[model samples]
Target: MNNNSQSLTYTQALEHLRAQALSKQSEEEVPLISALGRIVSSDQVAHRNVPVADNSAMDGYAINAEAQSASGQRFPVVGQTFAGHPFDRRLTEGQAIRIFTGAPIPEGCRFVAPQEDCEAEDGFVTVTRAFDEDSNIRRCGEDVRAGDTLVSRGTLLKPQHIGALAADGLATVPVRTPLRVGLLSTGDELVRPGNLLESGQIYDSNTFLLFGLLSSLPVNVTDLGILPDERDVVRERLTALQGTFDVIITSGGAGKGDADIVGQVVGELGNIEFWELAIKPGRPFMFGSINGCNFIGLPGNPVAAVVSFLSFARPFLLARAGAPFTEAEPVLLPAGFAIAGRRPGRREFLRAKRRFDGAGGEFVEKYRHDGSAQISSLTFADGLVVLEETLTDVTKGDPVPFIPFSQVGL
Candidate 1:
């Protein structure tokens, strides 16, 4: 691996990654049920009003308010309107229609009186209390109007967005095709699970970690499995995948060790840049392109690989998948524990979880261990406590920046 380039700070590395040009995936029309997690290809506009007409917001009696229809006034029940069923004729003066929620109000009706406020007997209803005009009535286009954009282009569809689209009468939507990614893990000392481990060998967990992380995004991943630390084999296999996938990701062979051949092979096959980031856990990473396919190399340590993926690779994939790239906002929270002393250089992400104090306040507490090899720390953590490069120590009750796993797609 080349080591001539200067190490970049965490912020600088992120900016560099964001500046790179990306080729978005092609667009496809998919049903609403299949569009979740997919990036919208175009703005989805509502074809009609949300309710389509003025409707009852509650189960009540629809009435036309007049001088005679006051408190204690009696009116005969004219008809009943259920959901998807409207009264056949317009309501007449001094008469009430039993209306259910979501039922369209009759043309001559001006307001709806709550059933609790009216007494109904022998086909006649009496208003026990006076109500305002247009009360309990949901006006047309109150929630959403025709020509309104239900969802904008490049927005990632979530469950709430799906509900809104369905409410606006959208059965199908245009979304970007899934980004094709070729995932590979390289290291002679790594072996797959369910297999006997030889001396100096450990089970390969980075591939499955990357797989689970990528599954949450809109991408189609092809696991290329593990590769031994052989320069010739690595070069030949990577060369064969060039131009076939939108992106190729590899873990383990990204450092400067003699056994790390992924960076060296990539440099020989195509252009590759080795970026030594000033970040704890994942310092060595490679980013570039092989032929037309993009490449991202992460550290071998399970924790480092996860941090690198969340910090760098995830945003790159999202941009390439046609979604607007935006960093997850860090929340300012109090530290429940204290760090007496620490190095003041590289930015660090500590595994931690939020705790409530019962007095209506929350704070973060770091895990007992900070080693990059301890993958179990992440399992017990709800978020990461971010320590800036200049932060030397943390005192209890001090405000620190935190990034929750949910925000970064755990």
Candidate 2:
């Protein structure tokens, strides 16, 4: 592996890691109720007829169109049809049957006049409004045809998709099993929150941050907790977890320093493909695979971890889980404030709050103290202002690309 730290940029590192990622290899059957957020592994076809049969679209009378329009168009109300009942009543000419919404349209009925459009007298109803062929008639297979492909493969099932599949009468769907991911943090100077920290020690926040981000994604996250900055211990832990997780994510210990053992361990235990990106706040990153499991080593700084995750790791993970290409496109919006002192040939992501000015104009105000180590900036920011590598100058009103926190799986 190349030990040159200055040769890699964020984009190059991401491309290299993404090239090594393999799509999900396993799948399982899950009930529709529990299928939300899971990726479909096979195309799902409708087993039964949608609507199953012709039904009523409103609470009105079901009558034959020709009979209702005939002379002396007063039809006797023979019976009624509710949502779950079968309307077995046979209709004769000039006879109407009362029907409610979702009730199956009875035999010989070609149109339905809503209750407001008819006048009921005694046991007969008179059609006061003209009837069209499909005024209130919901024909069978109108919304979905039989044996039609309802939801295709590679779709991430949401609540709406579940309902649609249910409408197609599917009780269960085949989906890829959730990928199990392991997270690790390395540093002897880091302590867990709520514990009394020794002098010159800071709290371990990367584990929690990575865990939270991974929890919302369609993967099973296992927090390996914190590991001390000892080479033997770190190497032992990595060796134990190398084959257990689909991917191992670590924070810190990736920079070019004497204590940075993450890159060295990965190189020894597996193939270390890329290191160091050209992106701001996340240049010291490592990506590769260990024992056939993907490995991503992010910067120790909170903002750098988040930025690398959003711009690189998130998309790679999503792709491995069978998400489509369009889902990874970051939402780009106009910059809200001026940005100065940016270096060319490096991409920068700034924390900012996104809002619309009066008259529905979009604006993003860069947060104060946008430092890589500032964890508060991530909490306060609504989105990120993305600066491209080609350009350095940015005016206040210039249109710059951005990614909202919501879009980036935050």
Candidate 3:
């Protein structure tokens, strides 16, 4: 794989990344109760039709359609049928079956008159209103037919989906196994939280940010902690992680610096497919692998690391886990603020907060500060505003594409 990304547009880079989704997918069978949020391995087809039989939709009198009636008609009530019980005997013209909601309509019964529209006497029912054709009947296979596709492959199971599958009498479902992912933060000047910071050092918040995002994904994440900028040490750790992880993500040590050894070590150990992206706030993005295990190296700047992860790494990991592609599109939002400067050469993404105004109009406001190192900007915003490369300026009320943190499971 080529490490250099020369003249590669953002769309082209994304396409290349998507093409790397896992060819060898893994899946497991689990009870549907525990399958929420898991991706389906294949289409879940219905084994049996929903509402297996033609049943009553309301508590009523199941009567024959041939019965003569205008406003008044009387018939003897022979038996009753509850939800879980059914009348075994057949109903002729002079007899009506007392049926409750969801009770199977006995043979020869064609319509149901609501219990409220009938007068009941000793073992008999007098009809005050007649049922129309097909009224109060939940026909067999009305909701779902046998062999119909219930849910397609790569679907992230939800409550409604589970309900539908359960109604189809499915007890177990096949879902993709979680991908094994590892995170490594590099930089000698970085320290984990709760430790006292010395001169020229910052807390290792990148690990937590990545961990939080990864926790929400359908992947198993291993925190490798912070490593020094030494080439030997970084190489040793990368070697140790190769066999255990499907993809290892590292932050820092990808730029032109004396301490930047991650990219070089990755090149020596495995391959660097691409090392740079044509985007602002995260240009020093690196995607490569070591010993057949993938690795994505992000910039040391906190915000840049986050943006790169969401824009590039998020989709890559989800696709590897066999997730659906239709859910990855960013939502369109109305731009609330104007662009500050002339059009940038590379694509730009701004952290923004989205909400509606008094008239229920939706808009997104961006943080004025565009520093890659600023962590406050991330917390202050709920989503990101994507500006196209061809776009120089954004006027108020223009449609701006926005990616919500919720979509990435942040």
- Give the top-scoring candidate (TM-score): 1
Off by over 4 Å in 3: 5-7, 58-79, 91-100, 108-132, 324-327
Flag the better candidate by lDDT, 1 or 2: 1
lDDT of 1 by residue, 1-410 (tens): 33447888998888878887364688899999999999999999998897788999889799876633468988889889998998999887788889999999998997888889889999988888877788888988999999999999988899999999999878899999999999999988889999999999999999899999999889999999998888888878987888889999999878767777898888888778889899988999889888778889999999999999998899888988888767778899999989877888899999999999989899998999999999999999999989999998899999999999999899
- TM-scores, all models, native as reference: 0.95, 0.89, 0.86
- Range of the 10 consecutive residues with the lowest summed lDDT in candidate 3: 64-73
Q: Judge candidate 3 at residue 313 and give its lDDT.
A: 88
Q: Is candidate 2 or candidate 3 better by lDDT?
A: 3
Indicate the worst ten consecutive residues by lDDT in candidate 2. 324-333
Strongest candidate by lDDT:
1
Model 3 lDDT per residue over 361-394, tens place: 9999999898999999999999888887888888
Q: TM-score for candidate 1, please give it.
A: 0.95
Q: List per-prediction Cα lDDT, in the order shown.
A: 0.88, 0.81, 0.84
